[model samples]
Target: MKPVNIGFNNMVMDERIVAIINPDSAPSRRLREEAKLENRLIDATLGKKTKTLIITDSNHVIMSAINPETISLRIGKGE
Candidate 1:
């Protein structure tokens, strides 16, 4: 699987990613809360401000400090 860097030395399987969302949205906040409740949340922000919410195919939610657009570009570049 291709891995995409999400910043702070974090990388996620590109193919496993289902969606890249802005964390500021109400729906995204709700999703994060639900993911936390289910214990499927992965905090990859490394204490930095969360800029993006990455939803994986396995129902895992990943918080990243990197922007969604940048992450999307990385995926497109196969990085």
Candidate 2:
């Protein structure tokens, strides 16, 4: 994986984003579209540099980190 240097703003930017989609959720068309957009960004930018993404939900926690060639995730339940 290639190394990179990500800044704090980038992480802050992503904190405002969420990337999960459960086809059954009752979101407005616009919110659904926005989720799709965030999902795309997650796929494209998730694990860059030493940057890691932390996502939490009511029942789970997901941690994601990446390098130029590798993307990894760790999941746990409030443990």
Candidate 3:
């Protein structure tokens, strides 16, 4: 699997990622809350403010401090 760096030394499998969203959005917030309730949330923010929410095909939600645009760029470059 190709892994892409999301930031702060964090990397996620590129193929498994279904969506990268801004954390401030209402839908994203709800998604996070649901993921938390389902125990499918993975905190990758490392105590920093969350900038992006990564939704995976396996139903895992990852919080990242890095912006979604930056992560998209990394994915575009296949890094």
Candidate 4:
């Protein structure tokens, strides 16, 4: 599977990603919390603040320091 670099050398399977969302939304925050509670939150931000929330097909929420718009653009480039 093609990989999308989410920053700090962290990568996620492109095809497995369901949505790339900003963390500012109410629903997005709730989803992140739920993922944390469920132990399905993947923190790829290292020590930086999370800017994007990558929801995967397996209900996993991958947190990244990169902006959502930048990440979405990276998706189309197929790196």
Candidate 5:
């Protein structure tokens, strides 16, 4: 699997990513909370507000400050 940089030097495996969605909706927010409660939330925002949420196959949620579109581009590059 290729390693995709989410932002701020954080990287995630491209193959493991299930979905990347904006975290503004109620359901997304609830998912973030649930991930937090389950200890499966990874904050890669580095103190910044989360703009995107990366969901993994293992049910882990990764919070990122970068836009989802930009992350998608990086994943496409497969770098």
Candidate 6:
């Protein structure tokens, strides 16, 4: 991924910035297993409250879960 320029309006000095980058690697068996478990949980729960974000590298390898709902809430608050 690339650092997206947000123009000068909101730009400020000394502000921390974050970026997401993907690399080349195959999905690990452990990740596949976890996803399968999560899927089963969702299915068993009948999608009562299910949210999963599996961000993988360029080669579809699971890197790490950034954040779940807290991140969503932060973005929502920013908006």
The prediction achieving the highest TM-score against the true structure is 5
Would you estimate the TM-scores of all the predictions?
Answer: 0.96, 0.19, 0.94, 0.95, 0.97, 0.21
Each prediction's Cα lDDT score?
0.94, 0.31, 0.93, 0.93, 0.96, 0.30
Off by over 4 Å in 1: none
Model 4 misplacement above 4 A = none
lDDT of 1: 0.94
User: Each candidate: how many clashes?
Assistant: 0, 1, 0, 0, 0, 0
Query: In model 5, which range of ten residues has the least summed lDDT?
Result: 70-79
lDDT (tens digit, per residue) of candidate 5 on 1-79? 9999998999999999999999999999999999999999999999999999999999999999999999999998876
Q: Candidate 3 residues 6-65, lDDT tens each?
A: 888889999999999998979989999999999999998889999999999999999999
What TM-score would candidate 6 get against the native?
0.21
Clashes of 5: 0
Candidate 5 positional error at 60, Å: 0.2
The true-versus-predicted C-alpha distance at residue 36 of model 6, in Å, is 17
lDDT string for model 2 (1-79, tens) is 2222223223222233234332233453344355456653232344443233323332122223333122222111110
Q: Model 1 clash pairs?
A: none
What is the model-wide C-alpha lDDT for candidate 3? 0.93
Tell me the tens digit of each residue's lDDT in model 1 across 13-47.
Answer: 89899999999989999999999999999999889
Q: Model 5: which residue pairs collide?
A: none
Model 4, TM vs. native: 0.95
